[model samples]
Target: MLKTLQTIVVAGALLFAGQCFAVDMTGKVVEVLDGDTLTFESNDGRLFRVRLKEVDAPEPGQTFGRQATQFVETLLKGKSVRVKISSVDRYDRAIAVLILPDGRVLNRELVSHGLAWHYRVHFPVDPALRALEYQAWKQNAGLWVDPSVVPPWEFRREKGARKPPPADPSAMDYNGIFDYGLIGNPDTKLFLWPDCQGYPEDSRGFAVFGSELHAQKSGFKQSPGCSRPES
Candidate 1:
């Protein structure tokens, strides 16, 4: 009787271990919500909202936000993807590393293209991924075009208390009209603005300009959006 009970206990422990170590999940991408959010349907018909681990993209109205979303849409929308969940985030989103049918890693691709920032919240130090982000920044790829690219997390903080830029006609470029709705003041520590448009007026969105130096001069703030510009 005692031996029988011991055998049962061992079997139960093995079963629990198997569940805990399950790493692979197959799903079809149903939606590409943004640079980092995706919806997928599993084989068992379970729907999951996945947040890419070790990356953060811009919000829709933020600077370069639309471009980031479009980039993700081009990459994964309506495709079959395999997810490897590492953990769950504070917001209860499944944090995962995604691979497409072709075995292309979505997390690495985002960092390489500068579409997403390397998120280290639950991730251990990964030098390879960090190096990819640096390489993308150096090449001025994707969102790296804007020197004042602010991370989405920081953008949320500066959405308030942002004062309007000095109304100097010289400061305003006649040929280069800025979309104030998405402007960011890169000079200040907390680049705050009222809305999600351009700097001062909208501080929560990504900067849309291609030139990072131009973005800085145009009053876009830097907040962990990507690596600093080359010296």
Candidate 2:
């Protein structure tokens, strides 16, 4: 009797630990709401709004948004995934890392495919995510395929229009009109064409501008790379 009681106690403790870290469970992904959101059914028959951890994909109106959603749709195909439950968000969604049968981490794969951002705030636990993002930037994968890019977070803040890809990243003719972002301050704006050698890196604190007029309006005076004397 005592041995049975001990086994029960140990099992309960293991369950608690799994809850604190992450509960490993298999679930059929019934819906791919977006690139980063999904609905799944647990084996035991519980439904959950599963938010993919550590990646933020573009919103509906943002550039490549639909493509990102479609990317996940094509990947999942209403199939089952091994969900490692992380934490629950305020909306009661079971945030998790969904894994494919082939051993792909869905969250990492999204970022690797340039379909999402690493969401560094929620994911400092893994620097590999940051590396994946950087690699995507370098490879010009997905949205980064366009040099003048705005992160989804910045897009939400500015509510700006999405611009088309640069005609040519390697060309020096900026034409004073660009569909991407340029950053500068009151003194001088540092506008690098998407193909410019020193365009968007992971560095923070610089503001992104969609147009030359917008940059000028914001007091970002174009000295060199951004403008030419209107000849």
Candidate 3:
């Protein structure tokens, strides 16, 4: 029994180590470029432009854009943070999750405070962040106070519609059938209706289920966004 327990403990330790990410470095935030982007300087005098992963705050043209920047600037500028570098984005920004001085994850905090969005394009939606965002919406916090609030993603999309050509019939070959169900946020272990407010973006991916039975057999539970039976 003792040998078996030791083996189990060693296996667990290895599993945990495999799951842990190596933080590239720690730094002092020197600039707040926007709600989701910033500049930081490491102790060794290296500077890096870092983007807060999984949080997409508004652009300056959108409503509450200034407020979002201000919120991030107030909390992050001149603060000590640890950077868990994930990957470098196309723009050459270091994709990272910042652990702030308060021991809170900055990405989650911005979404929690209604100052930013839970971006699904780069990462899966965290359920706690989803719930916090929902609560902020329910309480009419910040951007949520705007009843006609268009999400940043939607707002950006609409910006392109200001002057647009009519859809070509040839390019409009999309089928009229709507036979798709979603298994959203592999991290949150939840599924969402495609139209749900917190639906994961296509970049993060949604496994389309042609039938509900497929969704069930694949171990995805229906989220509240859908009217499917919760069983």
Cα lDDT computed for each candidate against the true fold: 0.61, 0.69, 0.65
Winner on lDDT (1 vs 3): 3
TM-score of each: 0.59, 0.61, 0.59
Clashes of 1: 22
Regions more than 4 Å wrong, model 1: 1-22, 160-231
Specify the poorest-scoring 10-residue window by lDDT in model 2: 172-181
lDDT of residue 146 for candidate 1: 60
Error of 1 at 164 (Å): 12
lDDT value, residue 215 of candidate 2: 67
After superposition, the stretches of candidate 3 with alpha carbons farther than 4 Å from their true spots are 1-21, 122-124, 160-231
lDDT of 2 by residue, 141-190 (tens): 98877776666766787696555655777442233332334565423455
Q: On a 0 to 100 scale, what is the lDDT of residue 106 in model 2?
A: 87
Q: Which candidate leads in TM-score?
A: 2
TM-score, cand. 2: 0.61
Which model is ahead, 2 or 3, in terms of TM-score?
2
Q: Show where candidate 2 strays beyond 4 Å.
A: 1-21, 123-125, 161-231
lDDT of 3 by residue, 134-211 (tens): 687677788766554556765675682332322542332111111233455566656666555676555345565534
Residues 42-108, candidate 1: write the lDDT tens digits: 6756555678877878777587678778877888767777888765544545667899888889888
Cα error, residue 208 of model 1, in Å, equals: 26
User: How close to the true structure is residue 158 of candidate 1, measured as C-alpha lDDT?
Assistant: 67
**What does the lDDT read for residue 198 in candidate 2?**
55
